[model samples]
Target: MLLAVTRQHEVAANWDAASLLADGSVSPEAGCRELPGCWGLAQPGPGPGDRGPCYAVPAAVGPQLPDGCKAPRLVCQLHFTSWPDFGVPFTPIGMLKFLKKVRTLNPAHAGPIVVHCSAGVGRTGTFIVIDAMMDMVHAEQKVDVFDFVSRIRNQRPQMVQTDMQYTFIYQALLEYYLYGDTELDVSSLEKHLQALHGPTAHFDKIGLEEEFRKLTNVRIMKENMRTGNLPANMKKARVIQIIPYDFNRVILSMKRGQEYTDYINASFIDGYRQKDYFIATQGPLAHTVEDFWRMVWEWKCHTIVMLTEVQEREQDKCYQYWPTEGSVTHGEITIEIKSDTLSEAISIRDFLVTFNQPLARPEEQTRVVRQFHFHGWPEIGIPAEGKGMIDLIAAVQKQQQQTGNHPITVHCSAGAGRTGTFIALSNILERVKAEGLLDVFQAVKSLRLQRPHMVQTL
Candidate 1:
């Protein structure tokens, strides 16, 4: 959302000045009353490092007013997490959609929009220019970005700082002229859900279908699978058809000059609140099983969701990577089952995973890992009921409440169909719970940008 202000806390926290911010969050009960001169946000049920772009934080700001009243100011803080520092957003559409919601909250008549980034210039100016550019488009069907930028610099030097930042102003404006906002509100959720599930498109394209087309067609950046296609790494893929793009592919920690060992058929997919929220991968092949556990250890993920059985419908869907009863060692990693609980819909297993340190190293490392296996859906077709998936996601969320929202490892047969669908649902549910907004088309499109053919079932 800026030219230099990249991360969340670097821009602003709890709608306060960026300079006075740190990387800590407050519970709802412990408000700004504890910190005299600082801003505090009542976290709305998100684990640490889990809050995404466009999260609504209930904040309490301390006052140094002349009136001498020591009351705290209640504020609604909107944070956008994906905008790269000194660069434009990957999806200009997401920025425009955020702008729409911002206008809703900060009406012109109410007061001036309070905008600030780290340096008080680049990102701040870009947002102000975009707001003005869109207003000009609406009123006169014309925009003079150069003229506006020149004017803004007169007021404050270096408003739109970088060449990419200047170019991005036009990109966002032109995107509005090309593809209008396609995000869905919570109020109209039923209509789109019906369009997705029902046989209603007789002649005209369904609304959801049109939205999906827009999402796939207009990717602003060129995407390619560079490292995954190398001759050395091709053997690791479970399904040749699906591979992650080079941009968001999860890279393994390189040992001292280790070659090609870092490649895995996994992409870091974004959840509603954070990037790399899910490490989506293919079902572990016999040779690739060790790489899968290595990914969990490297990424420090505590939760794994397996969407298919070891063999489904007489076909080898996944290899049995874990032991049925006791501990199993793969490479240096030893996984022991601490407990197993199964319901009609899901099987929850807790494993005590230990990595034997090298003889030179001082201490052994151990972690508690939880795997949620759900095989209720049919292998060939859709599920009999949607509630099972919703509840299954709820159970995963319950575990995330304990794990503090590290990147979750999700695998299906090809890590494309059911894996993608589950991630999209997880993202949508999280966004809806926090912001009351849904854009199924945008959600799936974001996934496909990271990896190929996510949400393949839909």
Candidate 2:
């Protein structure tokens, strides 16, 4: 429970104030460490004015503890410089963003955390109320704001100092729940189980049983028949003809003087914020590799998520279209490996892709495309465990966020099973964060409308 920073002088004078934790000067006193330098302070920007930055503080530098009292060796302080003590933040979204940063810095652990503000009440109380209610919301699906605040006030008399601050707590909780800052109390055992297996077999299994009861549902299967602008000659170019239906598949519009038809076995998938957040496609075959690069350039995609490797279990899953060292020309698209790193479960390659425009004077246009190659997932089945998959997805998401939200290209062997599941999980978790609960059945159902056989299992 930390309040937002107020006046600069208050930070200088009040050692325990939130402002001091952020931009305070160093103390020359015996145990007290010097400011700035002592904290190893660095501003994580978007910061002209205090959006807040995190720093490390050595516990030994602070005042001595009572004899035999255990003390933490290192203290990490996440300071908010945004709001003034007199008022709430200009926007709740900014506070939510800062709180998310704090959580990222300090994940859950089995211990009571120390929270304080200058007065130990105002903003401090607001933060505690919001966090407690947020936790309650995650554990259970709802929260009683009035009851929770009353309880906190009983423990710490006048806990929330002002009515505005009290209102802010409610606002923050709502913003976090509805705008994507969800935290769940998933046990380590459940996570382990989920990582190894897909989802628990508790949901939608009955519906799936009923759906599979019929040999084929004509209503559901009809949506896959509408392939727009798909020429008959280019139909055979698709890796898996039956899985990718026409309606939901991504249609690449042809450019002037293009040698081949603008066709690729890819479809758009929705994300939390964007309708076409990702383009789910099959791993490129030897002939379609050039088309893949063309799609990447045309879409201005910054990230390419490769779920299947070039070869898996002696089968050719994807073509090695990317160059190992130098540049490789695929039709009018030339991709050069600027840098690459291969880890155990995933490989990240930074490619400098140049698109040649014959009609233009410059002719060549370049952009950086990052390719995340997931090496462990099997071509025909899910991963043996999900931790690596989760990590890989998280890394890709972090990059996407930093690089500006663009339509990412995700692909596997046929891009129907593994590819669809990956997209579904990403969207489902986002929906949970944004809307509190998830509807996996609706998520997969909507996806199947866009691309058939998505989420291949219940």
Candidate 3:
């Protein structure tokens, strides 16, 4: 059997390691289960799948060897799963990771590494340069990017397609030289966290504080074309620090009367298995409560996870936007609280949120939104309600499944610190259950891409 491993866009270390057969049959635990078009036929494995590109490991590609042939010829192919169909990856860390894995598994004298994409020019050439340059950097401790690209283009005119891809080659090298290898195995995660929490000298070279400081790069790298920062949208934000990253921010195009007015201080944070899984936003301000309801209506959100109370520290962190009784209207949207379950740590409220606009689609008329509000958070102290938090997450996930597959709305005072913790908790919990791996750092980093300053503590 041939060897292969698959990973998604994010750093999904929890995915099962699969052994691929000649006929594209994967181990029973393979993560993806979809019938892709380019795959020709729907096989149980991840191969010839064009709909969602995946990776193939170093294998001897050819007909079955003679009865007991020794030292068979080896042919290796590794597709860049993290690379986009259009552009290079957002960061070189993931690409560097893929390269490290390939080098480690590849047996000595494995012929050569062959990389290809659709056109076999842009990403293809870029990947070749990265792999080649890293070798030079390790042996000679020097790099000539322009010289290398020019040297490569001599044989193939299409090598190193765009300036961005060219720049990415350098970014990948720099990341490698600076951070050696940051990808941790799932088994070593707990030990790694314990080390990060202490002030030991082992972590002194690159401490937890330094790792947290990398959020600055994560923000600048994912450049924002922001409407949240605009004058018209600024007032809608309840917190000055919570500007939604425009890359995945939700748009409000279905407004009834307002034209050219689609703006909300909300960003789409990806979940363990889904993109745009959670809408991370600031608690609704007094004037923007209507806008908040509009977001719920537009996204057809099924769950709202409120991590903070309306009034905290004698301040109105969130405006009173829900009713305890029958129903209430907030501009173009109305909310009716059907049931309110109270507990020492969690207060569950079921809401029937509706848009007053006239539309043919009945599904858009109203949606059942289960709000999971936790009262365990202290204004200035750390939370100690571990069991309650897990229970709340269980209830929320149950509600998400009972309802349809819709994005979950999560918010706090600024939607970064507390909100991020809950989302990461849910994400990490779900990943641990499904993949048998735990990587809290990767989960936190994913949140920062959608909105800045997510999961600020260890």
TM-score of each: 0.80, 0.52, 0.78
Q: In every candidate, how many clashes are there?
A: 2, 6, 0
Query: Worst lDDT window (10 residues) for model 1?
Result: 25-34
lDDT of 1 by residue, 136-227 (tens): 99899999999999999999986877777787789889878766665777989787678665543544666556555665564433347878
Pairs in steric clash, model 3? none
Give the runs in model 2 whose Cα sits over 4 Å from its true position: 1-240, 243-247, 255-260, 358-364
Writing each residue's lDDT as its tens digit, candidate 3 over 209-328 gives 766665456653334745666777776777666687777788887555875368888888877666678998888888878878888877889889998988888988888789979999
TM-score for candidate 3, residues paired by index: 0.78
* Alpha-carbon deviation at 248 in model 3, angstroms: 2.5
lDDT of 2 by residue, 1-458 (tens): 22232333343433443332222221222112224664342222231322221222212223346789776243444555555434576346446655665565564762455665555566677777777787898899898888987888888876777777778887777656643532333334355435435432555444345433321331345444545224652443444443455645666667679743566778887665566888988888887787788888888899999888788789888888799999999988889999999877899999998877767556348888899998877656678998887788788889998888989999887777778888878876664554354544445555666676765654
Q: Who wins the lDDT comparison? A: 1
Candidate that beats the other on lDDT, 1 or 3, i.e. the better one: 1
Superposed model 1: Cα runs more than 4 Å off: 1-52, 55-82, 140-144, 192-204, 218-224, 255-258, 358-364
Instruction: Order the candidate numbers by TM-score, best to worst.
Output: 1, 3, 2
